[model samples]
Target: MKGRTIVLDHIDDREAAALMVDGKLEDFLIVGDAPAPGTIYRARADRPVKGQGGMFLTTPDGPAFLRQVKGLSPGALMLVQVSGYAEPGKALPVTDRVLFKSRFAIVTPDAPGLNISRSIRDEDERDRLLEIAHECMDGSSYGLILRSSCAGEDAGEIAEDINAMLAHADQVINDPETEPELLLEGDGPHVLAWRDWTDPAEVVTQAGGFDTHGVLDALDVARGVSEPLPGGGHLYIQPTRALIAVDVNTGADTSLAAGTKANFACAKALARALRVRGLGGQITVDLAPMPKKDRRGFESALRAALKADPIETTMAGWTPLGHFELQRKRARIPLSEVLK
Candidate 1:
């Protein structure tokens, strides 16, 4: 219960991982039946959706939809990667731009360049990483990116990671097979927990770590419609057919700034709730009845809170009925569906 901790375990026969910060569940990931994002496939184009500038394809997993495709005729074979999860009754989202991602390096087939993460501000570290990239990539045409996690890591390890990713990219890109197939399966929850949770934490890899560390209790709270926010306020997260509806309640905090406190609390907790539950797409928040002048402050607070989130989100601004909106990417299957 002190510092950061990670618990890797299986829940109901599904691979699951949890990131706990000071004993609270900060993030969660679990395997679902659908193919995870980053899965590579040798797929064939099927049909174009008129007026949408998109095309449908048949992948090894199932049907996939690619956007902004051109010069591709029906039955054309090309490599595609899963960009994100699909909505209910929708085609799996995919893209032609394939990327091989690891903890320390990323191989980009579409973009050709060698770059280091801007977060590595130390010139010496940047130069060292660039040397490793150059040595690993050699004269390859594919682009290589040294991720921020490489900072302070062993040079030999970094070089090894680069070489591994390069090897994977080559194998997937030059399969020489003309038939549709699953070239590479996506990284699972346990692997992703090691890759993305870079912060220093105590690792728990044995089974039942979830129960031992209270992750199961946290998940049970996450499954509920109402979420506890700071400052005695709370919010209900309900996923409907069209969008996620969140209603804020002050919960007996009768103070002069009660509305402002409740709204800000909701703003901070909303993103985390959505992330923990793997809910995405349109999100509409009905804040407490605060003065309209506080709208800008609320927006700034929400943006700041969302900055730490890895998923792509767009603040769609306030609506006519005083509700705030956000367009979030569907990067993971909904937890309710996955758990059920």
Candidate 2:
């Protein structure tokens, strides 16, 4: 580890080297080359444009893109990005860049069936889906989605996402002076949800930073309707032995009952799970069977306890395994982690 660090607009080689010093990693050396392939495109294909709008088709070149989507199983999630070529165009051979999930046969390119658009008409617009969309689609129509789509989502959102993808494709196409490549490739859902231990308020306002604005908005939408004390924004998300472990420890509210009351405890945990797990649509909750000592008293207490939260929650039934099963809406993230 004695070579100097070298940063670049983009890396040219698949593998690179660096050096470590004094048991501490330098800022320059730290940006190692764990390059994600296929998210960005470096060259314009030798193929010719075929329709009303000039279109170019780029495929996944390295296994990194496919490997990123692969689960514990041998198979992987295939993401086919067909740009330059618009709909009503003839189908052509899949290029080497297009990394198929299992095999090349699984991916296809066709015009999207729906039309979706978003615009910001407000001065203080915090929601910039439209701007993002514009930045994404340099100008032409395109479609794409995060790996989260595996979570039983409807066609509507998927369609809009596809358009958003196309928008991104457009941006890459328009920029010729700069080396065009994938700016932001979607990370595995589990990794993407990792918590950021920082000042929540400042993080929220930063001009450029990894902001959990999407998660925050989703939580805000279901706020009072789901639970009070809208997420403090200081999230401690991380990977653990089990599913994503999201411990919602409070800062100022140090009340003993907040941690001691059965109903309060269950409700708080439930709300945190609902948000952290991102269990949208509807999900089933099976609470640990209330202490057997009180039986009916425990059930009544649990029921009265959760009365304050707002989301449409219900107590289904108990399982023979001593677990209570309740059905809640299936949020996208809960279903998308095909990884395990």
Candidate 3:
């Protein structure tokens, strides 16, 4: 019920991982029916959409859409990777900029450089990592990125991870297939948990860890539309076909500052809820009515909350009618859709 606890478990026999912070589910991941992000494919080019600057490629699973694609004629073969989940009945979203990502290193093809994560500010450690990079990446044209997890990690382990990723990249890049084929399957939830959840924490690998660690209860709460806020306020999160709507309500506390207080709580609670539920796309917030001057504070609080989140999101500024808007990447499928 305290600190970080990672629960590796299963739901309906599919792999799932949940992160609990102080007894509350902060993040979660589960296997979905669609092809997972990071799946590599050698796809043949199909017809291009004249107006959209994209092409529908043929893949083993289904049609995949790649945006910003140019200079490739029909029947040409190229490698692509799934960027994220697609909406129901839509083509799977993919990108040509493929990356080989692992726990300690990421290999970038067609990108030449050796770099370290900026979070590791220790110069001595940076030098050590750079030396390891040079040693492992010598004579290689591809780029390498040393992840922040490499900081304070075992030198031999880091080098070994780098080498392993490089070797895999070589194997994948050298394939000479012309037709559409699945090169590598994306990582499952358990593997993603181990790769991304590198921070020190209590790891629960036994079966039924979700129930034992309170993840199931927390998920039940998250599944509902109403989310409780601090000091008796509440938020209702609902996903319409167009966008996600967040309504903030200040309970019987009609005192001064109640609106601002509820609005601030909405920022944090809404972010956590969306993150845990894997909800993304356009978001419009119906904030509790507050003074014009206090809007700046609310925006600042919202910005700070979103900055801490891992997903790529951008604030689209407040609308003319005082509605705050955000655009989030579809990095994961909606929990409601996946569960059903």
Best by TM-score: 1
Residue-level lDDT of model 2, residues 294-329, one tens digit each, is 445545655664464333457665557554444443
Give each model's clash number.
Answer: 0, 36, 0
Ordered list by lDDT, greatest first: 1, 3, 2
Per-residue lDDT of model 1, residues 187-262, tens digit only: 9999999888887889999988999999999999899898988887889899999999999999989887899999
Clashing pairs in 1: none
Backbone clash total, candidate 1: 0
Error of 2 at 19 (Å): 38
lDDT against the true structure, per candidate, is 0.91, 0.31, 0.90
Give me candidate 1's TM-score against the actual structure.
0.98
Stretches of candidate 2 exceeding 4 Å from the true structure: 1-111, 115-167, 171-184, 187-318, 324-340
- The true-versus-predicted C-alpha distance at residue 179 of model 3, in Å, is 1.1
- Which number leads on lDDT? 1
lDDT of 1 at 110: 90
Q: If scored against the real structure, what TM-score would every candidate get?
A: 0.98, 0.26, 0.98
